[model samples]
Target chain A: MLVVSLIAFVMFRFVGDPVDQMVGLETTLEERAKLREQLGLNDPLPVQFWNFVSKAAQGDLGISYQFKRPVAVLLSERLPATLELSFVSALFALLAGIPMGVYTALRRESFLSKLFLTVSLIGISLPTFLIGILLIFIFSVNLQWLPSFGRGQVVDLGWWTTGFLTVSGLKALILPSITLGLFQMTLIMRLVRSEMLEVLRTDYIKFARARGLKDRAIHFGHALKNTLIPVITITGLQLGSIIAFAIITETVFQWPGMGLLFLQAVQNVDIPIMSAYLLLIAFLFVAINLIVDLLYVVVDPRIRIGGAEA
Target chain B: MSDALLSVRDLVVEFPTRKGILTAVDSVSFDIGRGEVLGVVGESGAGKSMTGSAIIGLIEPPGHIAGGSIELAGERIDNLPLEAMRKVRGKRIGMVFQDPLTSLNPLYTIAEQLIETIRTHLKLSERDARERAIGLLDEVGIPAASRRIDDYPHQFSGGMRQRVVIALALCAEPELVIADEPTTALDVSVQSQIIDVLKNMCAEHGSSVMLITHDMGVIAEAADRVAVMYAGRLAEIGPVRDVIQDARHPYTKGLMGSIPTLMHDSDRLTQIPGSMPRLTDIPPGCAFSPRCPKAFDRCFSVQPACERHEDREVACLLYDEGGRP
Candidate 1:
């Protein structure tokens, strides 16, 4: 996380001046110098970095250069939209991916399995931006069913504002979430399919069959649980990636998420938002991996002993 | 054979490939009498395991029972539908795999595995099934059965796991248990313990066992009767003592010779001249004929039918009344 903070801090420098974006060319040099001083941009490099880190640790992320608002408040407002989109996308990916994978694995020669494999191949092959554009083109321009831009009709609930309560907000989320989640869904599906295939061939599965276990018990109860050990780790990391990489989907739909905020901050050399976003993404990845490690203990007993000893 | 608990007649298992259909078990036949321990010994690819798989209806796709019937306690199970066959499996015919490490699901507790198997084939409640599982565990000689039943497979040592496997197989008290190399993967010291548990438990349950292994010592110790397979065909079969002491088939003699005996003064263990023939390249005559030291003109030209000589069935031209020199 500190390494990411350092990188984000370095990005704050040498990526053009926030003062250039803040003021027009007619502003006097003295006025510009005063503004830089006021923002502590005139401080030594190490001192500026120390101040950034210390203040960030205390929940103060300075202020956004373009919006003239506190960076923490800006992020918190956009945070809900991004989190909701990510949650939906992650849920969509897993719920669709796992069963699709198991189906393809169990019925390797079936027509539907082949069709799913083909569609997933397309899902994996196409870039996120292209999928997002194609979705917008079909759903917004051609069919005119959903709005093309912005979060619609958010319902504020004191600390958090959410789109889930409104019909239009939920409808607007469908395209972007699908566009964001499609790649991850295909990835998880293929992973699960291969894992299920491998698990099905294991001696335990054969023994389960020989024990006269029902087909459902053998497949889901025995084989599927074993297959999920690796799937959990992959899905956890993918969840992090989905949130971190939602920028393309956000850009295409013009959704009011942190990715869009990050984009705007990057364009205007808004150091506070840019650095804070980087640090936040890093923290999410670490936190997700920790949860995945803990989940291993729950699913597999062999890991439980090792975890206890460790 | 008339009083057999499980009988297999002219069983043919084949695997179809792009080139041609390969006959893995070519018209093999055998029987396990009630409470009998029938040890099946052979080299790798001898179809000993395939025969066991055929009985349980577990022959994988592209490989299948090409011909012959399997009867379990007088009912034709070979031609039964998959759903019917499944019911016959754990309830009437249980199986023990070679690797205890991989046989039990690592994710499940031993109690969970055993209770499920018991409940699947019986009408016991969960608590009753659990108690039965624990009882079987104790019977199989797992120390602290009641407490350790909830432990995962990985928690048990190799020998203990095999014991657990035996307990699981015997929990439902099936009529037949096809234990395929049940002791092959254990320690030398652990091997006898596992074999003893398997044999004693089956004997107690009156469950017929078709013990498949390549270990001659195991067959000598555990088998009431022994069957030797040569390239998917039964080379010879008889009472274990008769087959071990006075083998009739040339292949069976060669197999007995290869075993290092304390009584034999020979410096080197005898080895058969060639490996078992692959399914694709099996000779037109008896599969062992090409490698048989006693091979002659008739042996090369004619496939020998099994000839009954006293208590043994030998597939050799030498045993034929008219074909013999």
Candidate 2:
């Protein structure tokens, strides 16, 4: 979370001077000074940072130069789209990867396990960009599903119901979801297989076997619990990584998410929008880390990471 | 009613190593009577624990029982496959391991783990299982048994965890209990406490025990009969008193002589002199001939067969020669 706040600070700086960009590119010197003074840009850097932070605390991220709306309002409106994509990705990763990984590990040296392991290795090695393009080709161009890109708002739901929040939104989600899921599932599968293999080697697991725990209970009850800590840790770390790649994914799918918004902010050098986006991303990274830390405590009671539990 | 509670004959366990087939346990055999305690004593790699694990079907990967027969209550257990073998582990045969810290699964509460063991084998309601858990916890001598039941494995001290393991093992009232160095990891004082609990419980329940360990003191104290293994072979098997006081086999004598006894002025307390040779490096003759002090040319050249006496079995050429080492 501290990293998140600091990213918010750094985001403000990434767009160059806000005052110069706020006014016209050809504004006169005296006009620039007046504009700067009005916007509090004339204050020292630290003071300006203080104002930015305090205003951000009150939910005002100033105004976007291009949109002319509060940055927070813009982000708040668009934030859920990225969250939806990430959620779909994370869920699919676990559902797809865990079983295959477990099967591979348990099978050990079998031909089928080798095949699955090989595929998983290939999956992990491939870049997310390559996967995104391949997915776009297979699902979008070849199959012609939902016209290739962009967040689609709802036009008709037969009743005055949730608009842009219904099937239309879900339809907009598939391409990005597959892209994120493919990347994360590959990594998670590898981790799960390796960790399960290790857990299955433990003396306690041997004891469980000796206790005549059915293979199912031994795998799920004993081995899985021991293996989940690593997968969770990897999941937490991978969230930041997933967010990083979402920039490319959001760009590819043309989804109207924070990634796309941040892309525009970077390309246009729009100070408020860029700063707000960077800060939010940074905050998300740090904040998710904190949550994962707390979750570590939840999953495995033995850990007291950062004295949080104590 | 003449059925032996546990019988193992010609048990052979081998591991494929980089060099060759390393025989970890070679034709080692014994039996336990109903309500008897059989102690298997050996050095670090003498296959004592391997024998215990093979009986419980806990021998892991890379080490396979090349050839063996294990009988529990007159039934051929070794002929049974994995699924059938699993039924014997906790239901018919129980195990308590060396380290109390590592033996119990760490994730669950003591109550949860104990109840899991009960419900897995026994047809009992949740309330009945809970009642049984509380009773077993008290039987294992834990203070505040009802309250501490909710605590995790780490919450208990080493001795307490061993007691919990003992409680778990005997909860099903298994006909055979294989305890592998159950108290070796505890403090010296706690060791006797754990052993006392085990002895008292086994005595009360009339369950046969295959106590696999290296501690001569433990073997002398608890085992009714003792089987001394050397380098994966049983060097001697006899009643505990005979085995400890008047060991007939040279390897058994070497092991017995190696233990410390106070009030005796001796050089280095009768050390075994050399380490047990590696599995791959066993001499062609008797496996222990490399380390045996009484090795003649015959003892070093050709392996001697096991000779049977009234209530003892000695595997040495000296027995064949009609001479005692």
Candidate 3:
């Protein structure tokens, strides 16, 4: 987290000037110098980085250059939108991906299996922004069944506002979440299909058949259980990527999420928000990886023994 | 034949490839009487394992039983539907694979696997199934069967896992157990112990065994009758003593010669002249004619049908009624 914060601080520190973005043209040179001094811009690089790190540790992300508000407060307000979208997307990917993967693997030559494969291929190849626009055009422009932009109507509950309580808020989440989740769904499906295919050919599966296990038992109980070991790791890592890269989906839909805030921060040279986003993303990646490692022990006994030994 | 618990006739297993159809097991026949141990001895690719797989209806797709009739306890099983065949598989005839390391599902506890198999074939409650699983594990010589029943396959040693496999195969008290090279993957020290466990457990369950292996020593020790295969065909079969002491077919004679005997002071063990013929290039007449030391004109021109000899059956022209005419 510290390294991520440091890199984000160093890289964004050079992009335009926070002072220039914050000041007016009528301001005199003495006033500008006084403003820089007040903002502690005259401090050495190490001292500036140290201040950023120490303040971040204490949950104070300094202040946004553009909003002139606390970065943490801005993030907390926007965090729910991105998180809700990502959670729904992840749930869709896993719930749909695993069964589709198993079906494609088991009945690979069937017509429906071929269709799923083709659609998944398209899902993987198409970019998120293009998908988002296409969905918006179809659902919002032509059908007018769903709203195209903005988080519809959010409900505030003890500082954690959610669109879930409001019908419009739920409807508004549909397109952006699908656009963001399609690639991951396809990825997970393809991964599960390959893994299930390999597991089916293993000796244990053959032995399971010899033991007269029902197809359902052998396929899901034995094969799918084994396939999930690797899938869990990939899904966890993809979840981290989903939150960090929701920027394009958020942009196309104009959802009031952190991705939109970060984009605006980037345009206005808001270094504090930029650094905070990076640090948060890096922290999420590390935390998700830790969870993935824990899941390994739960799914595979061989790993449980290894973990115990370690 | 009437006493035979399982009988296979003219069984042919074939795999069709882009090149052509490859006959994995061609017109093979054998029988395992109730409570009998029939050892199938052959080199790799001799269709010994394929024959067992065909009997259990577990041949992989595109490779299937092309022409065959299998009967268990006087009922025809070769024509059974897939679901019916599945019921026959673990209920009437159980199978033990070669590599115990890869045979059991590594993710499940032994108790889970055993109980599942037990409940699938028999109408047992969960508590009854667990008790049966533990009992079978104990019968297969797994010490601390009750305590170790919950352990996953990986937690057990290779030999111990084979013992668990045996326990699983016999949990429903199958009438026949087709153990394909059950001891092949174990250490030499563990091999005999595993064979002993398999034999004792089968005996106690009153289940016949079709033990397939290339090791003649294993056959000599475990089998009541022995069937020697050469290139997907049964070359000879009889009581283990007669076949080992006086092998009738030249291929069987060659196979017996290759066994390392402590009594023989020969400098080198006798090896068959060539490897078993591949499925694509089997000779027109006898598959072993090219390697047979006693091949005559008829042996090259016509395939020999199995003929009854003094005490056993031999598939060679030399054993014909006219005696090599």
Give the number of the best model, judged by DockQ.
1
Cα lDDT tens digits, model 2, A53-149, are: 8887787888888787888888877777777677778888889889888988898889988887788777778877687788889877888875458
Which has the better TM-score: candidate 2, or candidate 3? Answer: 3
Compute each candidate's TM-score over C-alphas: 0.98, 0.94, 0.98
- Candidate rank order under TM-score: 3, 1, 2
Model 3 — interface RMS deviation?
Answer: 0.7
lDDT of 3 by residue, B1-325 (tens): 8788999999999999998999999898888899999999988999999999988989898998899799999999888998999999888899999999999999999999999999999999999999989888888888999999998998899999999999888887899999999999999999999999999989988999999999999999999999999889999989999899988888888888988888989998787898888899998888899998888888887898876777688899887867465
Question: In terms of TM-score, how similar is model 1 to the real structure?
Answer: 0.98
Clashes of each: 0, 4, 0
Off by over 4 Å in 2: A1-16, A154-165, A303-310, B263-267, B321-325
Candidate 1's residue-wise lDDT over A1-310, tens digit each? 7888789888877678878978988999999999999989989999999988898889888788788899899999989999999999999999999999999999999999999999999999999999988888998999999887788999999878899999999998899999989999999999999999999999999999999999999999999999999999999999999999999889988999999999998776788799889988998899999999999988889989867877
Root-mean-square deviation of Cα positions for candidate 2 versus the true structure, in angstroms: 2.9
Instruction: Say which docking band candidate 3 falls in.
Output: high
As a whole number from 0 to 100, the lDDT of residue A127 in candidate 3 is 92
Off by over 4 Å in 3: B323-325
DockQ of 2: 0.70
